[model samples]
Target: MKLPLFPLNAHVFPGGKLSLRIFEARYLRMIKERAGKEPCFAMGMLEDREGGAEVLPWATQVRMVDFSQLEDGLLGIVVEGVQWLHIEDITTDDDGLRWADCKPVSIWSEPNHEQDASINSALLSLFGQYPELGKLYPEAAGQSMDWSLQRWLEVLPIDAGNKVSLLNQLNSKPAFEFVNNLLHQGDP
Candidate 1:
């Protein structure tokens, strides 16, 4: 399906939440026009290649969950990842907005195992430390393996290139290993 693109320097995986500041005229117009009628957009991580800046193929289709005007007079929006998509073709509008034709990409399915208690505890502690992050997933159960991993992906300061590679995988094992190793690097 064809959708508007809102590529960023960051990433959000399926079932993740991201808060965005809408300021550019092109995007402002996009929000104004698309909100309510559709309220979904495809977001890919921006990358600087040797030629120019480009939006990577792996993207998440997010639905606007809430919006409010911030104190700085910018539109503050909270979006939730609905599905993962691989962008196929891109076209730029006259106003510099981008639109892409995309196909759904399979990501982690819910793991067969029960929720990891350690993950739940760790995430609760994390959210406690950063209440702003807590606000993003008010409805989460804080235990499912996929949910725990996706939150870690969004929370960490990993670069876009690594994120894209992790995202492009058909399953979550690589991601699980990556996050696990990173988090437990110094542990005995």
Candidate 2:
């Protein structure tokens, strides 16, 4: 399906929350046009070079869950990712707004119930120490290896290319092992 694209320098995994401030005229118009309609958009990582945005091929389909005017006078909107998307074609308008033809990609499956207690405790500690991040989601749903791995991948300061590579893996075992190693090494 064709959808409006909002490319950013960040990544959000399925079931993850992302907060954004919209001020650009094109995006504002995009929001206005889609208000009460679908309330969904495609978010892709952008590599800013010189004067252009080189958007990543993979993106997440996020649905707007909440919106309000921030104290700083910006339109603050929070969205939760619903699924993965692969951009098939894209075209930019005169106003610099991009519309993409994308296809849905399957999300990672739930992992086996072999979670490490220490890793789980460390993950919980992160939320306890940072209350702001904790407030974004409903509650601690990362008890599973899949959820914990996805959350780590989302917040890690890794490059988008590497993230896409990891995300495209057919099985979650490799990703789980990667997160397990990080936790064991105290990389949090």
Candidate 3:
């Protein structure tokens, strides 16, 4: 399937949610046309926005969850990741919006690792500090390693290339181990 690509510096993984402030004319138009008829869109990681928005190959298909007019007058919309996709080809509209031929891909799978209580505890503590982030997930996403790993990947201030490497894996084992190591970094 094909969808409009919203190249962003920050990204969302499956079961993860992100809040975006829309201000660009092209993107505003995209939302205006897409909000009701087709509330689905794909977000690709734009590693270097300074140079230009060259979207990465892999992306997450997202659906508009809610929208509102921010006090700053910009459009604020919250979206939840629906599926992972690999963009096969891209074409730019005359208005500069990008459309991509994407095929569904699965990079996150249920790892055999047992539930780590600390993962949930740590993430909940983080959410307590940032209530806004917590509001994104109304469900108990921190209850499982599969869900927690995606949140950890999205929230951590890690390198984009590192994130891409971890995301490209076939299963969530690498990401789970990576997050576990990070959470227990100072342990003897």
Give TM per candidate: 0.89, 0.88, 0.91
| Model 3 C-alpha lDDT per residue in residues 1-188, reported as the tens digit of each score | 98999988798988899999999999999898888654388988776657665677888999898999999999999988988888899999999999989999776553456677788788888888899998877675436777877788888988566787887786777887899999999999
Residue-pair clashes per candidate, as listed? Answer: 0, 0, 0
lDDT of 1 at 16: 86
Off by over 4 Å in 2: 48-53, 109-114, 141-143, 186-188
Best-to-worst order by TM-score is: 3, 1, 2
Model 3, which residues run further than 4 Å from truth?
Answer: 49-53, 109-113
Winning candidate number (TM-score):
3
Indicate the TM-score of model 2: 0.88
For model 2 the local lDDT of residue 127 reads 69
Tens digits of lDDT, candidate 1, 51-89: 977788878888888999999999999888888888899
Model 2 pairs in collision = none
lDDT agreement with native, every candidate? 0.80, 0.78, 0.83
Q: Per-candidate RMSD vs. true structure?
A: 2.1, 2.6, 2.0
* Alpha-carbon RMSD, candidate 3: 2.0
Model 1 segments beyond 4 Å from truth?
50-52, 109-115
